[model samples]
Target: DTAVSQTPKYLVTQMGNDKSIKCEQNLGHDTMYWYKQDSKKFLKIMFSYNNKELIINETVPNRFSPKSPDKAHLNLHINSLELGDSAVYFCASSPGGAGYNEQFFGPGTRLTVL
Candidate 1:
């Protein structure tokens, strides 16, 4: 069984469009997170949630919104997508939380803005 999964593995859109990425985890972990992997292969944390409360919000643009409906789901909604938004978005789950526990990442969602 897939421990962590994301929808629409590939996303292609034009600039100024809006998009969303859905993430789900079956690991029964206490915390879940969202990260953006740049072309340089650098992973940057975008958001983190524990017990349905947002714990981390990075210095990303306000167009990016992270929503957690529950402990098992983390969905990212982007408004007015820009070219800079093109990257691989990953969802991860940390057993205890995003603090120091190992994070299991879901297959990334590739976003391309034209």
Candidate 2:
């Protein structure tokens, strides 16, 4: 049983292609999020969702879109992937309480664009 899981742990593709990264958590948390970690290891929040509601972070690109089928799942879809998009995508979750809650992260999905 995986607490958090993402498909294609390592994704290598050419520029301009489209790809989707799937994420799921079984922790029964009310909120889930997507984060991007660059080569410098700076973790940045991309999107947050609770039952399909969008809560995006301003730093994220317009090419990136997040979809949540339910409280336990959130997927990322990218359009016209670029070389700059190469990074590690992490799925995380929290209990959805007041204030900032601690997040549990997935193993990560590394995307490489050539």
Candidate 3:
């Protein structure tokens, strides 16, 4: 069984289109996160949810949104997708909020915008 899973492992679309990626975890974790890995291989956290409450990272743009209906799932929605938004998005989960546990990442969703 997969500990963490993301649907539609690859996404290809044109600029200005909107897209969404779904993620689910069966680890019984309390905290989940959305991270983006850029072309330069820089990984950055976009959003985090603890028990369904959201905490957005300060540097992330408003075009990115993360919603969690429950503790085991976190879904990412991107509006007005831009060229810069093309990257590998990863879903992760931890037992508790920041600094308490190691995050287990999903297979990742690669988004390509033309």
Candidate 4:
């Protein structure tokens, strides 16, 4: 009964490979998001979806794509992964509203490139 969960706490792969990360939420939230934290620990928003519709897209590489199976799940797929892609990917969710709704983040999936 976790509010938010992500599979494979760590991922390691060679450059040019492709991989994916799964995310799910049980809190009945309407908005879901993906964030990447670099080695500097700067968390940056990548994409956001509300009610299965994309609402925010921060400047990100095209190799990264986010898919929402439903309001409760959002998956991230990365193609042609590069060394630069090696970072901690986090899934988050929040209630869709006008105010400053706090986002609940997953433990995070650390991706390592070789």
Candidate 5:
């Protein structure tokens, strides 16, 4: 019944590791986004998809990729995670690709890289 959902709410891994976070939305939204909130609580957009096309991609580590096979899903894959990669990864979705649209976020998946 959730609008958006992510698996493995907490991820704890060592440095130089790899991880994947799965995200799914049942709201039938066409635009989905992956956001990272650092320790300072400042959220930044990592990637966004609209109709399976990457609409917005912000500056982030090349090891981080947001893969979306469909409109209702966006899965994050991190390779060789570093300590700087530790943050709360959030999955969000909106009706449109515009950033101004009201976004629905799922319970974040906290990634802690030691």
Candidate 6:
């Protein structure tokens, strides 16, 4: 079984549209994260959740939201998407807390905004 999985592996939309991507992990990990990979291939952490509680948020815009229904699932919602938001979004999970364990990432969801 996949340790981590994301729905709608690809997303294409206009600049003003709204979209959401869903992620789930079966690894029984306590910490999960949302990362964005930009065109220059720079990976940055957008949000982190531990056991359904928000932990780290890296100054992300209010238009972006991360929700964790439980430890196994974290979802990302983007409203009024912008061109700058076009990037590969990755869902990851780790056994312990942030920076303490190896993270297993899902095959990313590529978002393209026109």
Highest TM-score against the true fold, candidate: 6
lDDT of 4 at 110: 100
Worst 10 contiguous positions by lDDT, candidate 2: 50-59
Superposed model 5: Cα runs more than 4 Å off? none
lDDT of 5 by residue, 31-64 (tens): 9999999999999989989988998889887899
Per-candidate Cα lDDT values, in order, are: 0.93, 0.88, 0.92, 0.93, 0.92, 0.96
Top candidate by lDDT: 6
lDDT by residue (tens digit), candidate 4, 46-73:
9999989989888898999999989999
TM-score of each model, paired residue for residue: 0.97, 0.93, 0.96, 0.96, 0.96, 0.98
Error of 5 at 103 (Å): 0.4
> Candidate 6 clashing pairs?
none
Candidate 6's C-alpha runs over 4 A off are none
lDDT per residue, candidate 2, 6-109, as tens digits?
99799999999999999999998888888899999998888888766876555777899888888888999999999999999999888884268888889999
> On residues 46-83, what C-alpha lDDT tens digit does candidate 6 reach at each position?
99999999989999999999999889999999999999
CA lDDT, candidate 4, residue 65: 91
- Evaluated against the true structure, the overall lDDT of model 1 is 0.93
Indicate the worst ten consecutive residues by lDDT in candidate 1.
93-102
lDDT of 6: 0.96
Clashing pairs for predicted structure model 5, backbone only: none
How many residue pairs of model 5 clash at the backbone?
Answer: 0
What ordering of candidates by lDDT runs from best to worst?
Answer: 6, 1, 4, 5, 3, 2
In candidate 4, how many clashes are counted? Answer: 0
**Cα lDDT tens digits for candidate 1, 1-114:** 999999989999999999999999999988999999999999999999997898999998999999999999999999999999999999999988555789999999999999
**Candidate 5's C-alpha lDDT?**
0.92
